[model samples]
Target: MRRYLLQDTAQGIFFVTISNLTKEDSGKYWCAVSTKLSIGNLFDEVSLTVVDDKTLATMFISAC
Candidate 1:
């Protein structure tokens, strides 16, 4: 499967999809929007964690 996909859903709106995630995929990511001025750039940072399906299931079951 493709590792990454980027799409422009609407004006000034975007989406990113990371497929076939693994533990190694966990890390910091950045999203940025560019403008004419270098200092006008916008940025957002995200921390992502990928867990196995079994682990997620266990978490859900334990929470119930």
Candidate 2:
């Protein structure tokens, strides 16, 4: 089984949180919506990249 946390609001704002993220989760994610105020559907995509602890350490070290 898989678990996910979703945060949303009355406004058109939304968020998806994945705890204990894994490399398999790295990909393009999008939110698609349709409302009475709009004649057509709208969608936006976001990129999520998950890195391993070693990669994170390397990034911080290289940035220094």
Best by TM-score: 1
Which tens-of-lDDT digit does each residue in 1-64 have in candidate 1? 4567677755666666676667877778777777887678777776778876212211101110
RMSD for each of the candidates: 9.4, 9.3
What would the per-residue lDDT of candidate 2 be over residues 1-64, giving only the tens digit for each residue? 4446666654656556566667776788766676566567776666778885212211111110
Task: Tell me which residue pairs clash in candidate 1.
Answer: none
lDDT of 1: 0.58
Which segments of candidate 1 are over 4 A away from where they belong? 37-39, 53-64
Question: Residue 16: error of model 2 in Å?
Answer: 1.2
Where is model 2 more than 4 Å wrong at Cα? Answer: 53-64
